[model samples]
Target: MSGWALRTEGLVKTFTLHLQGGARLPVLYGVDLSVASGECVALAGPSGAGKSTLMRCLYGNYGAEGGRILIRHRGETVDLTAADARLVREVRRETLGHVSQFLRVIPRVPSLDIVAEPLVARGMAPDAARAEARALLSRLNMPPALHALPPATFSGGEQQRVNLARGFAPGYPVLLLDEPTASLDAANRDVAVALIREAKAAGAAVVGIFHDTDVRDRVADRLFTVEPRPEASRSAA
Candidate 1:
């Protein structure tokens, strides 16, 4: 229940703009970040500083152009950049959880099922997963009536709550959050902060991008500022 839960070494990512005749744009450059169990690290930087890109890379949604994304998976260190597709899927199911700023799930899937799908995917019984999902949704103040309804038509705040519930429900060892409290009111923001505190207290290594200074200070143990790299500019085709 100690030491580093997640770390990146010499990590790099680049984007190739096809429309611009394959102009290459590099984002991260040898970024070193380590987060310990039971601690929360907030990513701080201005717009276009690659904070979102870093989060995506950490979750294996984007391939690292170089270096490694090391995560503790089932008590072993796994380099995500080198993990095969099956292993990456397994890692995502059991070890790492992410909450994006926006909610994106299958259309017409009820809110409850959306939150519970990950748990069920990990082999938990459907009933148990649904039970946990119901509890999380209730805790997040999503009305009971909306539980059986799809979240696609929900307000931004409502959809965000469902997203948070889904991400926090699994209790993954390492959690990545992007603008978690963006659409919530003050009261719900307090609840979101409490959930983050609880996650850290329960030994989840949390990395988050919190533009809200008040919420960031309340939940984050420290800040990791990702400075913009001058070399990230697009190179000539």
Candidate 2:
């Protein structure tokens, strides 16, 4: 196998505007991206340029209109665009990890359990998973006291910490981070950067959208610009 861990060929995505008489809005088209193992690729683009859309598509959250989203899974390259829901879930469990901008989990679930759930799903014993979660949370400055409580009432920074710990704990080969450090303070931001660097060192392929130039410079090996297609951006009535 080559060094590339993830790549997309001619990827395209579109959204239908039901409120606008079912008009079609195109976001991304003909996107060809490649990321290697142990590298971080930052998505650079304007606010309306569909970087998030592309990220969601890459993660199989949004079904692509066309193209192939390929990633190395279990030593084989699998096309996520062609994968079934079950295969996608399996891939997410074993190969791909994503840290979105917000923490979304079952309401009232303790922060520790929230972070440990993924590990448990991956076959780690619950006790061991929670132990790993606790250590990671502590490293992110999440107090032990707060670990037992639900993060629904936590501040933005605190919730972000739980999200980070959960996503990084699984040791996935491919990671997608959407503004991982956006809500963090200086100290936590530094820790986030360190975690990213550590992941890369351990051969995790990372793709992220970091508006913070400092964070981008620290972690991104290169930038892939998502240029807006004016025609696509315009809704067809």
Candidate 3:
């Protein structure tokens, strides 16, 4: 019922993968999604359905061929799709968070620093960022001893928890998660779901892609499915 935190209209992206025969692949068709502040949505579909690509486009890591991404702040809506890269980056630093399908912990960056990176970019002092990072990690039940080690050596579940902390550390209004729980074990998977609910309760609009039906059912206030078009279905038939 509150303002929308993020939205997309007619989003489309195509990639031309150079195959052995010089063939190209068109990945995403026109896709539209919207999320209100404090709400959560799950995107479920088969592999190659462009869910990750859509998440990238939402964070401005990739561009969309045709669409608008609007983010509301205060009383105004900023057109993220039209904004320049610098503006996009700034907005992301200030009010948006993204967790990718693959874990991308910078080599040699300590785990605490990894969680503190976004807040540092937003001009928070080192002490404050670390304090906040510690709080989030603690919330996720991370052991205190692991905070100083590089996350590269962490277990998959630990690393994923670190990823979740980083995305949530900034308290961004829009959180885009691409298969965030894929690397977790059963127990850690449950932790990830709880963290997602916390994010929404903190007023972030959460959109996540997942294959686990339990995850989709538990975390999503609304659900949307990506399916093949009628043309493709008929063609397959």
RMSD of each: 1.8, 1.5, 2.9
**Per-residue lDDT of model 3, residues 2-85, tens digit only:** 477888887767655466454444555667787998899887777766677777888888877777888875457888878987
lDDT of the structure predicted as candidate 1 = 0.93
Off by over 4 Å in 2: 232-237
Determine which window of 10 residues in candidate 2 has minimal summed lDDT: 228-237
Cα displacement (angstroms), candidate 2, residue 25, comes to 0.7
Query: Which pairs, if any, clash in model 2?
Result: none
lDDT of 1 by residue, 1-237 (tens): 349999999999988789998778888888999999999999988899899999999999999999999999988999999999999999999999999999986788999999999999989999999999999999988989999999989999999999999999999989999999999999899999999999999999999999999999999999998978775244421
> What TM-score number comes out for model 1?
0.96
Best by TM-score: 2
- Work out the TM-score per prediction: 0.96, 0.97, 0.88
Model 1 clashing residue pairs (backbone)? none
Which numbered prediction scores highest in lDDT against the true structure? 2
Residue-wise lDDT of candidate 2 within 1-237, one digit each (tens)? 468999999998889879988888888989999999999999999998999999999899999999999999999989999999999999999999999999986788999999999999999999999999999999999989999999999999999999999999998999999999999999999999999999999999999999999999999999999989786347442
